[model samples]
Structures are given as structure tokens and as C-alpha cells.
Target: MVASCATCQQKAQQVKAMQTNIDFWPTTLKLKNSSDLICDESLRYLAGKRLVCRGRWQQRTVAVKLFFHPKSAKRHWLREKQGVESLISNQLSTPSLLFAGTLIDGTPVLIFDYLSSAKTALDVWKELDNDEARLDLLQQIVVEISAQHRCGLWQQDLHLGNFLISDNQIYTIDGDGIKSSTDGKELTTKKRRNNLALLLAQLSPNYDHLATPAIEHYAATSQKNMRDLKSITEKELPHIRTTRRHKYVKKAYRNCSEFIRHNSLRQVAIYRRDADAGLIKQFLNNPDQLITDGTILKNGNSATVAQVTIAGDSLAIKRYNIKGIWHILKRCWRPTRAWISWGNAHRLTISGIDTPQPIAILEKRLGPLRTSSYYLCVHENTPSATDYF
Candidate 1:
């Protein structure tokens, strides 16, 4: 028993040490918002509980990303900062990390040297008029990925949006998903092939024609057998797609946030602190009124959806309605659908996949048992899946 106690104490100390190390940042380049700093009037990108803004520091333009989700802020910030540092140490092409630290409110912030002329490979691919040009670009990207593998690193979230084209060179961005092997060995043939296959799978299904030549070029440049590369990629592609879909379905049923629970004679409500307080108040104050008056997008026996404008910003609100007393009793112990959808959306965005930005979730219960729930999210005006096809 004494030995076990000592072991437990040592493990506690190790965890404490790790947390202290993660919270530490060099003070040499710490920034303060003052006359010297100026930010652009509008945001450059906003998704996944984070926002990117253009700003000037020391007269040089920079991109500032603020990660606002408490649950993921520390992990994402550390992964991105460490990944950039690792790539730089290995002499790979990536954005220069200008500064990294936390804001006064404890939000993690990272500043990077801005590339004004850079365009995401997704945008460039959409503009290419011929297959030859597209194939050439794909070959260049494969070469870049090969270089990373040579350095014993691989980006788990390999997607077109993560590749940036500038000055005829392909540069990588969004380093949070990059990983390295734990055994200190060089990347093996299997690992390299899997990485290539994952990258190809992220492209639109319509680009299936480019897979053959792209794999052949990669195998040639990397000095691997073309047939081996083709065989591995063909087997891995379907598995990766199936895994992605399965992950989404699994995560959609889990609660993803710690919500403030409130109960009263009339209803029960739960919300997050980061969410807009005014909106939550309006929602809980009269959920029935909002459901009846808000513009309904869909209405079914199980649920209802509406497009609600609160504080001048449009939001998509989904309300799960109980069909009968039996339904309420069956679901009272399970997580609300609103909570599930919110978690799934956030997970998709953080994985470098596209989804609507989730705002908040509220549940109204009978006594301690949840009977109705509402999920609120930013109403994206982008093209639907059918439109893209």
C-alpha cells in the first residue's frame, strides 16, 4: 500500500509538471494591444470556434488566429505552435510563426507572417481549366508531402485547403494535425503510403481520374515501386472514407460541452458561457414563442427547425419536440439531439472537415427529465451538397 501511494504521488507530480510546461510561453515576443498594433476592420476567416484577423505588428502584416473554445484552446494552440517549430527546424516550407501566447482573457493566440498572394489549393483547383494543369499541381503537392514524410512527419488532416499556392510554390498551413512517430524511426513504406492515400481521399470524388497519375509521379519521385503505391492507395481510400463517416455518426450522439443548468417551475434550461448571453436569454424566456413565430425551415413530428435573427445575426435553431410521454421517458436519460449535433459540428470543423459553425445548445426539461431541446448555430449561406455535385 505504501508503494502504491508513492507511485500515485509521482504520477500526480508528473501531470502537474506537464501542465506547468504547457502554460509557459517565452516572454521575449509577448504582445500588447497598443498604438503600435492595428487590426483590419473585418475578419479574414471565422469557423470552428476560432477567428482569423489580419493585423500589423512592427509595420509588417500578420495573420492572428484566436482560438476561443475552452475545451480545445490549449491543445490546438500547442499542437500548431510545436508543429510550425518542428517544420522550421526541418527546413520545410511553412508560414513563419511570428508570435504565440494567450490573451488577457486566456484565449490562445498565434500570429504568423501573412502571405498576401497565397491561395488555397481548393480555390486554385476550382479555377484550373484543364486536367494537365491540375495534374501538375497535384504532382507538386505530392512532392511536398513526400518531403514531410522524409522528415518523419505526416499531416493527419491532409486536405486541399491545407495547401497554399504562392509564387509558384506550394506551402502548407494549419499545422495542428501534423504528427510524428513515437519510436524515433524514419517513416516506413506503409506509413508513407497511408499518408499519400489520405491526402488523395480528401479531394472531390470527381477528381478520381487524377489519382492514378498522381500516385505514379509520387512513387517515381520518391523511388518507390509504382505498382506498390497504387495497390496501397486503392485499398486505403475506401477505408478512410468509411472511417470518417463512422466517426461523425458516433460523435453526433455525445455531449460536447459543460452547460449551465437552470431549473424553475415552468422549464429547465442549459447553456454555455461563451455563447451570446442575450440570445440564450431570449431563447429560454419564450422558447415556444420563438418556435411558433420564427421562420420555420422544417417541421416534422419529431422536431422543428427555424431561421432566427437575433442581434442582427442569422442563426439556425433546431428544436427537438417530444412526440408523447413514452418518448420523453425513453429519452430523459440520453443526451439531447441538440447537444449531439453541436458536438458533431465542432468535431468536423476541428478535423479540417467542413460543417456549419455551432453556436450554442439549450434544453428544456420536465422537472429533472429533458423533454424538449434547442440547438442554435450560425446559418451558413454556402452552396448545398447537391449544388456542388
Candidate 2:
């Protein structure tokens, strides 16, 4: 027994030393393009605001996520690394982090063991034709959540996309979404129910029939009474919907590629789709010209809306007209109308409500006070609420 204990201690020390080595490993791999990758068989599998490539590393298949934004890359990489390390220490099932480092241009790169045959819960749900299979999957997800709860960890952003299934085993991904209790106590009743509700919210309204059985299974696995669980879930349903609505909206805003520029001339805010400074300046300088050349949608007292196609993309530009000198003074202390509307549009969109996608908000200010503002958004052909009424 003494020899075995000594061996374990020696192994632990070796592991600690190895980790320290890896943490300071020089990060010499500067990934400029996919061509620079060592693995020739690598294919560009996923491309979003960032890039995800599936390739072989160290004789094993791996997934590499490369961040485009330096700041975001550093922040998310650190959070995910911390979460994965915590899960590993607790002996929880998750992907093994093979490597994490920054490239020459300071872009963060994270490599993890790839589950080649795995499918996200969202993907499986679309393929599932029968209700039984769907229910089974939900049960599996609940069991996994219960296990995590028992470990005093809860995923703050629970959704179908975060859960992956392979070989009949469900594995949780998106380590940045995972949260743990610091007090070494079990999750509170409210926290557990909220987490469960978040999972349920991802399902379609038609799948309401599966809620009862799923909840029952979760309660049984968590060793909680079905009646009490049902009561808490019932009371929390409305609040859950509201919370999820806002959460999704915030997520949408974060996902958008946007930037703000300030100079001696004017303040400009631009989104990914409207990075053309010339086009934005044209709309800001010549609103009247656009009204005459472009399609006028609305001519209101306080605002004028026009649809203009710039570079083959249709956009709606709303010019907030200063009603008079009195109106300008009243709004001087507040943010520009364009800024307010841009934020409100995002709020409406994420709340499961319908609204045009806000692309950009530009304000031409004279010193500290605002002089003119313009809100640009994607042109949606949907009818107004008043028309239906």
C-alpha cells in the first residue's frame, strides 16, 4: 500500500510538471491560413465570425477553433480553458484540451479532441421522426444535467446546441457556458429548476407533450419529488420565457460584428455587413437625395424612412428629423434616437418578437450636443402590425 501511494504521488508530480511545461510552450505555431496547417487532410468544416477546422494533430483527430477578434479570442479561450480544467479535475466527461496558445498575430487558438461521429442535439432532433426517440434523447440530456448538478456545477446557457451525442452517450460542450457553486454546496432549488427550464425552452412548442415525462425522469434521477418539481416548473415557466428572450437578444448583439470609431470629424458605428464608410457617409450627408432617388417607405413628422439598395443589398435608413429647436433641447441630454432604436430593435428580436435587423447607427454631433442621427437596418418586407389589425 505504501509503495502504491508513493507511485501515485510521483505520477501526480510528473503531471503537474508536464502541465507547467505546456502552459509556457513558446506558442511558436503561427496559423496564418488553413494552408499553413500541418495536417494536409484538414477541411474547413465551420466558418462563422471565427473559424473551426477539423484536422489531425499528434496522430489523433482534433478540432481547432481560431478566433478572429483578438480580444474576444483571449477572453473566451481563457474561460473555456478554465472550465475544461475544472471538469477534468472533477473527473467529468468532456473533450480533452490538447493545446491552447496564441498565434503570431495574437489570435487565440484552442485545440480539443474531436468527436467525429457525434451530432448536436439540434441536429438529431431534426432527423428524429418518432416521438419515442425524441423523448429518449431528452431523458439522456436530463440525466447528464442531473449528474452535473450533483457535482455542484450548472450550465448557465443550457441549449440543444451545447449537448452532443455519440455512441448513445451525451457529452456537454461549450465550456464557457458552464458555472459552478463556490460555496461547495448543492445547487439551490431555484437554480436547478431554472437550468431545466432553459433546456425545455430550446424545444418547439409542439413538444410540450414531452415536458411531463422529461421532468419526471429528471426529478427521479435527482432524487426530488415529482409533485414539487412540477409545481416549481409551472411557477417558473413564464419567468423562464422572459429570461430566455432577453438572453437570446443579448447573444445576437454579441454575435454581430460591429465597431465604433470616433474622430475630430464625426462619430461612426458600423456593423459587419455595412463596413463601407463611403455608403454610410452618403446616407448621412444626403438624406434628401436618397428620398428622391430611393424608395420612400414612410414620411413621418419626427422621422423619415427610405429603402435604398447599396451594393445590391436592400437597407432601410431612418433619418430622425429634429422637429424644432425645442425638441433638440429636450433630447440633448439623452442618447441619439438612432442609438436608442438600434438597442430596442435588438431587444425585440431576441425576445422571440419580430423586428428588422439593426445594421448600424450613426450620429453627426456638433461638439457635445447631437445635431442629426440616422438608423440603418436590413429592409424586411413584412407588413406593419397596424395593417393586420
lDDT: worst 10-residue window of model 2 = 40-49
Model 1 worst lDDT run, 10 consecutive residues: 22-31
True lDDT of residue 320, candidate 2? 88
* Tens-digit lDDT string for candidate 1 (264-362): 754545455456778888887776677677798889998899888878888888888889989988998787888677767755663557676776667
Alpha carbon lDDT at 168, candidate 2: 81
Q: Number of the top candidate by TM-score?
A: 2
Per lDDT, the best of the predicted structures is 1
Name the Cα RMSD for model 1. Answer: 9.1
On the 0 to 100 scale, the lDDT of residue 248 in model 1 is: 52
lDDT of 1 at 116: 91
List residue ranges in candidate 2 displaced over 4 A. Answer: 1-56, 59-61, 65-79, 86-93, 100-109, 116-140, 165-169, 181-188, 198-213, 234-265, 268-292, 384-389
